[model samples]
Structures are given as C-alpha cells and as structure tokens.
Target: MLMMPLEIFATVATGLGAGLALIIAIGAQNALVLRQGIRGEHVGLVVLVCMLSDIVLIAAGIFGIGAVITAAPAVVVVIRLAGAAFLIGYAVLAAKRAVHPGTLHASTQTGTMSRKAALITVLTLTWLNPHVYLDTVLLLGTLANQHGELRWWFGAGAALGSVVWFSALGFGAKLLRPVFAKPGAWRVLDGLIAAVMLFLGIKMALGV
Candidate 1:
C-alpha cells in the first residue's frame, strides 16, 4: 500500500483542481469581488477574506470538520436563512444604486469607517453563507475523503488553487481600474450584482 504522505499530496492536488474549477465560474462571490474592484475600495482586504475563507473551508472539507458539519443539519439551515436575508438586502441596495449610485469619489481616499465596514462585510459574506460550507465542506469534503490518505493533499492543492485564483482576480480587477473609471460604472455594476444576488438567493431558498 502507498504511504500517507504520497496520498495526501495527491489528494491536495485534486482538491485544488476542483476548487479552482468551481471558483472561476461567475457567481455571487465573483460578482462581489469584481464590484469591489470596480469601486476600488478595500481591494486587498476583500481579496484576502475571499482567499482565506476558501483555504479554511477547503481544509475543513479535507480534514475532520467535514464529518462534524455533516452530522449537523440545522447548522446548514441557519446559514441558508441568514445568507438569504443578506442577499435580499444586498439586492435592494444594488437596485437602488442602479437608479442613483451617488457621486464619484476618488478611489485613493479611504475613510476609517468604510475600511472597517469593508472588512466585516467581506468576512461575513465569505464565511456566513451556507453555500460556502455546502460547497467547501460538504461537496469538497466528501470528495476529498474518497481519495483516502491522499485527501489531505487534495485539500492542500485546493487551498493553493484558491490563493492563485483570488490573486489573479484581485490583480486583474486592479488592472481594469481604468475601464471602471467611467461615471456610470458603479450603477451598472451594482445593478448586475443585485440581479446576481436575487438569482442566487432564490436558488438557495428553493434548495436548488
């Protein structure tokens, strides 16, 4: 039989590959990241939360927490409800912004309150949603376990892939700052975000 070390490494690779594949798709998560990039506010903070959340969840999936979460069904329900509320509220805000996105402010200035708010929002949005656990813990976790000893390696690969994907997205958005500089960019972005949120919210509520 193969050693655990070799199996773990391979497992991590599998996890990374799976994560990167799922993450690259357009979804609420990606939309938020892009919107933040367009707004040019707390870019690093947002990106860090996004990446760290992935790492932690993927770890949970690969390691012991997957089993723990699986045993607790109500926990998932709570997350889904909370996430639904957030999404609904977010959708309203986006729609409102679509009508009136406010004045264009210089991206250079960072108010203290906005900074704190950005950090909190990103953390909550990343960690609080049931989908995060479902995707990372449930799906990825079960997938990792199937690899036997290689599961750890699959998770390691998945986490690293997350780092790579988020870095690319964060930097890529930065590169497009000029394109986002247009006056109506925020309104359009917010509108799109709202639509995405609503769609995601409905999906969650209906258990799709």
Candidate 2:
C-alpha cells in the first residue's frame, strides 16, 4: 500500500512525538549519558551506542520480535530481577559519589573511565534496563504496527527521534559544565541520580 505524503508526515510526526515522550524521561540511562557528556568522556561513542540500540530495538519491535519476546514470561522476570539488582548497585555508587563530591577537575583526574570501561558501562546501562524493552520493543512496536503498511516509516521516525534526543542530550550537556564545575553541583546531581536509581530499582524489584 502506498501512503500519501501527508500520511507519511503524520505517521512520522506521531512516532517522533511518542518516541520523545518515552525517551526524554529521567532514567538511569539518561543520567549516565548526562554525566558522561558533562565530563567530556567519550560523548560521541555514548550517543552513538544509545542511538544504535534504540534503532535496533525499534526495528525489532516493528518487525514482530516483540511478540516472540512477550511469549516468554520467564525471560521478562529474569530481566526484571537482574535489572533491579544492577540499578540498586548503581544507586549505591551514586550515593557514595554524592557523599564525597568532587570538582570537575578532580573527577577528571580520579574518576576518569577508560574507553573500554565506558563502552561496557553504557552498553550495560542501555541493555540491562527492562524499561528499554517495554518502551522500545513492546510499546513502540505496538504503536508502529498500528500504522499498517506504513509501520516501517513509523519506526524510522522513532529511530530518528532517538538520534535527535541522544545527540542533544550527550552534546548539549557540556553547556552546563559551568554549573557542574563546582563540588556542590556534583553533589546535587549525584544525589538526584542516586534517588532516581534507587526508586527505579525498588519499583522494578517489587514489580510495581
């Protein structure tokens, strides 16, 4: 089936809006990206990984992989429990950082993460979170299929949304470097990250 230009535009716009609405939320992934961006630590690689992950997930969802995953309740449970544990552990680390805040320079010196470590961390953050599967694979997949034959276009739009958002977040975080230069600012940011992670961890654990 052929779609009119207007139909394509509308479908893309809908996908873009839905994608942004889901991804723009404050979560572990966003927090890590923001921190990496502000610290000037492999921002491009981080953003690229995030973008590619989302694109792949969104594609999977649109292509019916979501249905296959959904058929296995055990898989979801395992992912949820594992995700909860990781988030909680990360929360503890964030709390420690909050307690002993460091200036941007001090962080750069003592907290510098190797590229391989950063890559692994970002990938873990992206893949370990069950919310990614829920949002990208199930929800977005369902939404895309609603577009019928234009489903791929919807997925493309959602993928573009991910690219736009992660690019903005990872690159734009440096603009706040001035504010984050102080130890107090680091404390506040880490405190918030810890709180968010803990809340999410607890929520996931309780299956709430």
* Highest TM-score model number: 2
Tens-digit per-residue lDDT, 10-115, candidate 1: 6667777898887887777777777677666777888888988898888777777867877998888888878877777878877876776553332434222287
Overall lDDT per candidate, in order of appearance: 0.75, 0.89
Top-lDDT candidate index: 2
Q: Which run of 10 residues does model 1 get worst, by summed lDDT?
A: 104-113
Query: Could you give the C-alpha RMSD of every candidate to the true structure, in order shown?
Result: 2.8, 1.5
| Estimated TM-score for each candidate | 0.86, 0.95
As for model 1, its CA RMSD to the true structure in angstroms is: 2.8
